[model samples]
Target: MSDTPELPWPVPDERFRHWAGQFADMHHLVRDLVIPLGLPQAAESVLTTARELIRMSYFRYEFMMIGAGTSIIAIEAALADRYGKGNLAGYLKKAHADGHLTKEQYDLLDSFGRPIRNKYAHGDLTHVALTPPLAIGMLRTAITLLAELHATPSPGPSAGGN
Candidate 1:
């Protein structure tokens, strides 16, 4: 007998199970059909990685947007005393220019992250494709931005007692 312990079968909902079965069947059929195409192993590996990166990019974009939105809300709340009527991008730029974000961090977000996120949000996926490195960089910048926004001190009365 095998040394590995038997795991209990997961009981999924009927609809989910049905869909999963269909997906698996289709995947196997596609694989079988494509095997005869004689694609190089390296090319297949790259294709697989590209597919995963595309899926991961979409996931990261959604969370990055959420994180950025939450960070904006925090910044707005903290600076409510001095808040002005403006767009989110304006506030973000003001925050960066005012020394809230490091120069490198701001540059990364402004130059790459924001435009990609906007494209995805506006359903313009055809115009922008995200690579794994780019997605990772954007996520890192977003995390840093959120942390900085969260750690910011709330605005208060002038120090000179104005």
Candidate 2:
């Protein structure tokens, strides 16, 4: 048997996109973003997957939930390579203490532990309807935060994808 657990929802087939090619296609600010030098490959992979899922959310907006939720987990995974252990919350303190993140950045992400991160993780019904703007913003926060935690200041936000 495959080790993968059964998904609660319908399995996505090759034709996952609906009304795709109808528009110019979704874009993400994080697309082609550079991860900090020496960042863990596994972490970078998760982060990419998270962003791609968010971009795909434009086709099926509900995918925003998966994207938003995965972004938090991506942050946590990035932390595992940088810090010792624990989830995003505990690691943020360590990241902050090390001058990896600014107070404002730390505070914003630490605050996400509840209404954003945890709720999505637990499959809260309200969170599934998470808006695209909110989900995209969360991902931006995650990518910037991860970059800071590693090294090299972020290039800073720019106008999002066309």
Candidate 3:
């Protein structure tokens, strides 16, 4: 007999299969998504790690919050990679001002994205809540934004000679 112990809670095969389906759906989402290779390695690692947490969250609800928190951190890391040494709003403002992001993109990020990320980053854990859909949405948004950030060419040295 296998030495493994059963979980205290019931984990029926059917339920496990169902969770597998959810995991597959999440895997497929990330599989089809691609981020630029030019991005800082840390940003890519963070995104991947966040996705793994999201996958695990399907197995356990607690992981969902951790995954959600990591998702926003991944976004922040991507922003830091692109903009460097600044807060979310400042980085986004620079992105918009430089025409790297469209007005709508900026507005979308500024509206809910900033607040959600801040809620986690600033440690508002008691009030923070997350569902799989919302966590997946956050992951998707982070990847999309990271791609956009990397795809945009950084401004070169100023035209005028030093």
Candidate 4:
């Protein structure tokens, strides 16, 4: 059996009761606000939300990289966890080995990671200005990856197939 602690409720956070109450209120407010706006289809809403998440996360990544000026390795390790073991970087590296990353692109990503790691490490939200271009790029990349993953065949055969 696992050694994880059993809690009274699923989410255990005793110290933040007030904050949690405020959060729940805000969540209800947002839901009420958006419900009247007549949103798109559920699938489209999910895609839109996912795109925003990727963009925001990348911006957060950048801010952290810039502020810390170190801890890039740890940040990348955490990203590897989120992106899964078979992430783009790992897959590309495995595909080409020596040719995985071009010198210029690798250097650019390395440069970007430095400060982003800092923001993530320090938990500071002071430097959050959304760049349209970055958001577009990240969103497009996310959509493409999601599409490709959806397109790929799963392991199991069709219901009637041998």
Off by over 4 Å in 2: 1-22, 28-38, 125-129, 152-162
lDDT (tens digit, per residue) of candidate 3 on 34-132 = 545766687788777777876665566556556656766776666676666889889778878976557766675676567767776777743655555
Q: Give the TM-score of candidate 1.
A: 0.44
Best model per TM-score: 3
Q: Write the per-residue lDDT of candidate 4 for residues 1-162, one digit (tens) a residue.
A: 779976553342333343234334323322321211232244235445533333233223343223222223322443343344644345334323433334543443344433443454576534644242333333333233333333443333345776
| Model 1, runs deviating above 4 Å | 1-84, 156-162
How many clashes does each candidate structure show, in the order listed?
A: 0, 0, 0, 13
lDDT of 2 by residue, 78-157 (tens): 76666555777787787788776678667756765335678777777344445555666667767787766666543333
lDDT of model 2 at position 90: 81
Which scores higher on lDDT, 1 or 4?
A: 1
Question: What are the lDDT figures for the candidates, one per model?
Answer: 0.44, 0.63, 0.65, 0.35
The superposed Cα distance between candidate 2 and the true structure at residue 8, in angstroms, equals: 19
After superposition, the stretches of candidate 3 with alpha carbons farther than 4 Å from their true spots are: 1-31, 34-38, 97-108, 156-162
Judge candidate 3 at residue 103 and give its lDDT: 78
